[model samples]
Target chain A: MTVSIIRFGGSNCDRDAERALEHLGIDAEIVWHEDGLPEETSGIVLPGGFSYGDYLRAGAMAARSPIMADVREAAAAGTPVLGVCNGAQIGCESGLTEGAFTTNESARFQCEHVYLRVERDDTPWTAAYDEGDVIEIPIAHGEGRYEIDDERLAELEDEDRVLFRYCDENGDTGPDVNPNGSKHNIAGVLGDRETVAVLMPHPERVTLPDVGPTDGQGVLRGFEAAENGA
Target chain B: MTAYTATVTVRLKHGVLDPEAETTQQALERLGFELEDLRSADRFEIDIEAESAESAHERASEMAERLLANPTIHDYDVEVDER
Candidate 1:
């Protein structure tokens, strides 16, 4: 069983995701969006980049691509699907997840390390971490802020769909700690099911020890847990 | 078949924060312009040949629904004119 990293046009992080999964001893492959999901696919990752040059909106064009319908089917069939950064935008746009990741509150691109407090530990994405565990991940995007209706946001919070939130080192959540003005500091969220999740941070960027902090390794380890049924 | 031009405009829903518009408003204020408020929207003009105005409106509305507007945050309107 291999994790299929779907590489849409302008997807630059497909290789990074592939290597990160390999480093964790999980077999993975990069699949072009047009070619369709392989028959052996056991998991999916929507890797990030400026798909369609961010025309109209970030991930707007890519999300409407025909392949996303299949991605949605796979996610519904209980396949673990994870989207990062621009992928997060696509996930929301394609209805694989809720809400939208729009322009940053500052209206500028931001690339920085931020702390994310795990909001739930039972999901496949956060299985390796405990609730409230703070992890560092680098987010690089101009449209990383999450926007949703107040009632919907509150419902997601009540439903345990929020996976991570921007927070201080001590896991205190507030506007001051929210780098991009996401509602309630939300940095990541699960779909209707915990197996499907999306986040603005790049777990692949921090998974390798040679690079720096491996706090994100746990996020990637989620693939391992899926394989083990954990 | 009648030739028609359909214009669709998409705007953020009420109460949704628009930072780009806010920044543009601030820039205009810095330039000494007095304005009560500022908002932004995307307009798309599509040309199509259909049997009737209603058909043209339907096609353009579908375009707006499928690609031009995101229902989660955007509300859009379509206007059609015969060419």
Candidate 2:
């Protein structure tokens, strides 16, 4: 399968994401943000970076880019689309998902290794992991805190749209353990199943066992499972 | 003919803390002035020449809801003064 990785003007992780996909045995290419979406691609990934220098609100300008129209259309067509960090913010800004506003508790840039408990394993991106499994991922961003109203929060919980919850070393979601003070300790969420996934953490950064976390295999395996129809 | 002044106040909603406002308030407190509550909000004044005060108020309210405040996190009140 081929994965089209979209690269904006300021995207920093495009190569890393492409590498990860390549290592996973999938053909991947970097597609420019201004160019039209690549056809005949099985999956699309919006890599993380400071798009438009994070001006006028994070991901706000990139959300309105010319290529986002095709991205939205691909997402609506049930194609697997994954957004990482600023990409996640763009996804929310583009109305690909529900509310993902500014941080609620601590409004500051945070960078650290965070534990995340898998809330659902049915999505294409998380199918390799069992429900309730905890994994470590790196998070680095200022606007990573997810905020929503009580009603919508409850609805997300009930719908199992919450894909991952931040936790501590012991994998317990709590105030002190939460890294970015995201509402519900959310780390990732799926829009309309696994077809559209957005996560604050950078899985691509942790995919190499020699360079990054050892748990990278599991995360990549998750995507590989989806490719294999597991 | 009637003249009306419309005032719009934009501020963070309750439970949503503004770090910039907090720092400003702390600075004010350091100046040794006893203040019960130091909250910061943006104020906009627009003078409109309308047929009636009610028309001005309606127009100001619409502006407040549409642009002055982000309904997701802020609530705005508009006051019109008839002259």
- Please name the candidate that would achieve the greatest TM-score relative to the true structure: 1
Worst 10 residues of 1 chain B by lDDT: B64-73
For DockQ, the strongest prediction is 1
Runs in model 1 with CA error above 4 Å?
none
Reference-based TM-score, model 1: 0.98
Give the per-residue lDDT digits (tens) of candidate 1, residues B1-83: 99999999999999888999999999999999999999999999999999999999999999988889988889999999998
Per-model CA lDDT versus the true structure: 0.92, 0.77
Model 2 misses residue A89 by how many Å?
0.6
* Candidate 2 stretches greater than 4 Å from native: A216-223, B1-13, B17-20, B23-83
Q: Give the worst 10-residue stretch by lDDT in candidate 1 chain A.
A: A221-230
**TM per model?**
0.98, 0.80
Model 2 CA RMSD to the hidden true structure, in angstroms: 4.6
Residue B73 in candidate 1 has what lDDT? 88
